[model samples]
Target: MIALLRGFLWLTGFWLAGESLVVLLDLPISAGVVGMLLLTIALLLRIGRLEDIAAASQPLIGLLAMLIMPGVVGVFFVADEFAGQWLAVAVALVGGTLASVLTTLLLMRRCMPAAPRTETPQETSS
Candidate 1:
């Protein structure tokens, strides 16, 4: 319980920092996203442990779909604004997904160590 409280504190602290940055810069991005990026950088730098975040995020992850449902539903309220641009939206979605997948694949390949190659029996016998 104490750990969960600490985790929430850390998360909220980062989120507030992100929101402050957005307000200062007048950027047009979600503060939560910026906060998450900051948190990821902190974790990668060993400034924070995954266990701390996991304590809070594990349950949230379980409810992710439900959490996103409001945003999905909200889109319907603005559906008329997109009445004639569905093809553009579809193309953007597909392009973005493919770009994300390709970027992830390339990054993983570059970051991960290659597996050891095994010689076949025939090559070994020769």
Candidate 2:
């Protein structure tokens, strides 16, 4: 429980810091993204270990479907605007998914190649 609270507080602190930066610097990016960047930096700097936040974030990530429902509902409400552009939306979604998959495959191939296997020949019995 204490670990969960610490994680929540840590995440909140980073999020608030991000929002504060947005306010101060007038960045076009959203505060949540800035908070993510801060979190990444903190991890890379060894200041914030991922284990500290994993407990708190895991359950929240599981609730993603519920969390995203509102956005989905909003999209449904805007369906009228999208009705005429259905083909464009379909193409965009499919193209983006294919591009992302191909890019990930390419990166994995470059970054994580499989170990080579060596085969030995068997001697035939006389």
Candidate 3:
């Protein structure tokens, strides 16, 4: 219970700091996205531990599907515009997905250490 409160406070503090930095720099990026990125960096640096926030985050994470409701609803309003630009939308979707996948692969390759190769028993027999 205490850990959950601490986690919430930590997340809120980090988010406000990131948002303020974005506003101060006059960055075009969204504050929420910047906050999320900051949180990710903190986690990667071990400054924020998942376990510390797991309790509080668990319910919110579980209800994440509900959060998509607005996006799903918004899509209906854009359906006509999307249909008119289907080809461009398709291209953008594919390009964005590919770019995201490539970026993720590159980041993982750089951040994670490669596993040591192990010799098979048959090769040892030789």
Candidate 4:
């Protein structure tokens, strides 16, 4: 519980910092996104260890689907607004998903070490 509290504090501090930056700079991006970017930079810089905030973040990560439910449901209420834009929305969703997957794959390929080549029995015997 203490660890969780500490983690939450770290997360909240970054979020507040991000909000402040957005307000001060008039950034068009969401504060949460800014906060996450700041957190990523801090982690990369070794300003804080991941363990310090993992406790708080893990639970939130688990609740991701549930957290997104409200937005999905809210769209239902405004369904009429999307009546004629379904094709565009579908294209955007599919394109975004493909782009995200492609980006992940490319990043993973770049960051992960190459696998060692294994010799087959025939090659070894020869």
Considering every candidate listed, which one attains the maximal lDDT?
4
What are the per-residue Cα lDDT tens digits for candidate 1 across 1-126? 888788888899899989999999998999999999999999989876678778988887899999989889888788798898998999999999999999999999999887556645457664
Q: What overall lDDT goes with each candidate model?
A: 0.87, 0.85, 0.82, 0.90
Clashing pairs in 1: none
Q: Arrange candidates, best lDDT first.
A: 4, 1, 2, 3
What's the best-to-worst order under TM-score? Answer: 2, 4, 1, 3
Off by over 4 Å in 4: 91-126
Clashing pairs in 4: none
List all candidate RMSDs to the true structure: 8.0, 9.0, 7.7, 7.8
Clashes of each: 0, 0, 0, 0
Query: Which is superior by lDDT, 1 or 4?
Result: 4
In terms of TM-score, how similar is model 1 to the real structure? 0.59
Give, for candidate 3, the lowest lDDT window spanning 10 residues: 115-124
TM-score of 4: 0.68
**Candidate 2 per-residue C-alpha lDDT over 23-69 given as tens digits, one digit per residue, 9 for 90 to 100:** 99999989989998998899889886577787778877899899989
Better of 2 and 3 by TM-score: 2
Query: Who is ahead in lDDT, 3 or 4?
Result: 4
Q: Point out the worst 10-residue segment of candidate 1 by lDDT.
A: 115-124
